[model samples]
Target chain A: MSDPSSLLGALRVVLVGTSHPGNIGGVARAMKNMGLKDLRLVAPRAQFPHPEAEFRASGATDILNDVVVNDTLEEALADRTLVAGTSARSRHLPWPLLNPRELAGRLQDELRQPEHRIALVFGREDRGLSNEELQLCHLHVHIPTNPEFSSLNLAAAVQVLSYEVRMALVEQAETASRKEDQPFGTEWDAPLATSESLERFFEHLEKTLVDIEFHDPNNPRKSLSRLRRLYLRARPDSNEINMLRGILTSTQKAAGTKK
Target chain B: MSDPSSLLGALRVVLVGTSHPGNIGGVARAMKNMGLKDLRLVAPRAQFPHPEAEFRASGATDILNDVVVNDTLEEALADRTLVAGTSARSRHLPWPLLNPRELAGRLQDELRQPEHRIALVFGREDRGLSNEELQLCHLHVHIPTNPEFSSLNLAAAVQVLSYEVRMALVEQAETASRKEDQPFGTEWDAPLATSESLERFFEHLEKTLVDIEFHDPNNPRKSLSRLRRLYLRARPDSNEINMLRGILTSTQKAAGTKK
Candidate 1:
């Protein structure tokens, strides 16, 4: 029911505490390259309309001219449903990390929902995403540069992500156009399983397993997580998940256990 | 023989007929971001070390400082063995156009050889690589852009390509390092059929078919090509090919009586 081009409109490129105006200009041009328009700067240190930025932006002044600068990151991300932070370094605590390509695909999937707003947050050039800023984001995206010299230019990182988004949109458009004559893909018969449905199914499965003594609730090692990862990777559609849930219910009933 | 990081040394980012110094600066920043050092300018309309460029480069002054200026494209590319020209628009004559990722892989494959120098040439901001300039380069690299507004900022284009190269290098390094302990993959036991061996098998199979009057060579449509494609897709290993050849020999001997 949605077109990939509209996904661009749903995306917001947010810069937090950007020190250089030229980098901002560079990002604007990068966003324009991918047909992305929304630009939100969270308290930029440099002055806006700095002739240097305009001079550097080249033909993408349209993006810079319409740029939105907020006093804080929360204000910039107030309307965003999904926020992804860019980081080159690993965190002390493990967080779900996505490369640019995966982030683009996830963004496209999220945009399929009604009125979903996506924010791709980039942090300061020197220190990268702060722990507070990182925690606020739903996912962290790493561009994957050389380990020896992994200092990717901020604008270049933006360009890489913008390119990935453009590619994802183009792929979706092509797939849609190609499917015009006849519907394809095995999953076309069933809508993709919703997040809430998957969560419910996991809860039911866990309860049933614990009741049946198949899983130890107290000492539940990585088995549940492994299963979750497997299911997520398989990406079962609604019908498939429903069938599996039914099987789980039946299995629990046969075992004379309550879920 | 070479690591991905060394590839940067062998690569030269060449900009032709650049009108703005800021773009040159932007290119330098992009190059430096990806660990690329060599910057060659061919007949720039703007003066060298323009303050605007310095202002825009942020901290990549080392790249801008060591820039090589030439009056002609040929002079800039004289030392390079592999040259890839960047173009945004399609041309009258179809050239071997590769997207940034494919170009990066091809560059990596080419760089496997000793003393190989590669050049990534970008044309002016307004009109991309001229027909004459294109003819000189071995391949054309096109960054996939949004069709609605495909005007990619020159430096952004540089950033995208540079990022791809860096990613490709990192991926190669990872794959190499991962394979160090306990080698994997199903094909490790047997070497895959070489192109020459596959071609010979195809020729033999075709001759045997004609000998048995199964395929009329004179009126053959796409049968030969189709069979070639099928075998190629299968990607038979040495043992598989040998077994298939033995089966074909037996089948031919049995079909002689019918013929």
Candidate 2:
């Protein structure tokens, strides 16, 4: 499933109640560093046109100058298909905490689908996103930092998440393009076996083990199913499968020689 | 040969003709974040008691309050050895442009030897280190960024360079501890392969490749050399070496069957 729109430009970064204009400038700079350009500021406390912002922006003043200012949070996220709010701590709300890596993985999968315009919503400096604001987002992303001191600056939070997203997008694109070049019929061409495939492999493996007297056939309840599942969950590759089969063949040959 | 007399506290960061006192405050904050306590300012345009700077300093007001005001660049670097200037662009001067990573590598090597206190000199935001100012340093450290747009803030530059120093210190300490734990004669107990063992494996591998007609005995120049370097760079563990030897033996048997 090839996406028609590019992932880079489709990402809308919305910063709500940004106290310092310089952090807004820093966020824009960090976003541009990771190839994201669309920036929106909602209900900012400081004047963004201040000379301090432009000076701190370095080369990313364009992102600041062209930023869309909104009065309300709803107006900022009206156009977005999916919204993810950044949170450092888990709230009492039932919203599950998706760490940066997990969020990136989910985003990578979502990007493959069409018309997926995602918005990364960040809260103010002093207090993070309110519970009502958290409810607006479909997912909550938490960056895994030192547990004792997880106080990440607003721009630093954006930097880490945006960096992970950019890396994941590039990696996924490279792998997809490589897969496209290879023929689709051969075993190698088949999608690499995931955990689901390994589960099916275990069922077949267990039956074979019982047939070969490797497990106790007399007591059906004394099955080696746990061992089967453990090996299958490891998700051994094709080369590993060939190596294991070779060992099994050699063992059988040695047993025949003894007989 | 560690030198005990090296002036650890002599390394001074001097900011000259700074337009904003808040940036001076930010520089102080950045310096403290990297375990640097000493800060010197030379002719700041903004007043020292600016409320914006104190507010922006967060808890780092100590750095701003105790800042030493200098009259000139000569006064700043008067008592320092091995002054290094930072710039993003390469000047025609014979001074090599070492990036943050390269500078850290050089500092790691230099810190091992006895030398005067190293001074990391930074310039104002408007115009970076002038030609004459740059000439004062033994070397120039450059942060590799976009060539078309390479303007980094004065405080940001200090933060990045200081972070590099902190990382280098931690890495040097870790290396020293590892060396103490595993001395020369205890090479067998070390997790990775020793140089002698790796050399033996490479010799056997090269001979096997020649025997299997994978490498040309005559006119062998580039390919084998590259392969050897690749393996040497990999620094394979004992288990990996054993696996490679097993594969080589299997390949030899397969070749014999074909013959």
DockQ of each: 0.14, 0.06
For model 2, residues B181-201, the per-residue Cα lDDT tens digits are: 332112322255668777777
Candidate 1 chain B has its poorest 10 consecutive residues by lDDT at B180-189
Q: Largest TM-score belongs to which candidate?
A: 1
Query: Top lDDT: which candidate number?
Result: 1
TM-score for the A-chain in each candidate structure: 0.67, 0.65
Q: List the candidate 1 regions with Cα displacement exceeding 4 Å.
A: A1-4, A49-52, A147-149, A172-259, B1-3, B176-259
* DockQ of the two-chain complex in candidate 1: 0.14
Q: What's the i-RMS of each model?
A: 16.7, 14.2
Q: What is the TM-score of chain B alone in each candidate?
A: 0.66, 0.62
The CAPRI quality class of candidate 2 comes to incorrect
List all candidate RMSDs to the true structure: 16.9, 16.1
Candidate 1: pairs in clash: none
User: What's model 2's lDDT at B50?
Assistant: 84
* Model 2 iRMSD vs. native: 14.2
lDDT of 2 at B235: 47
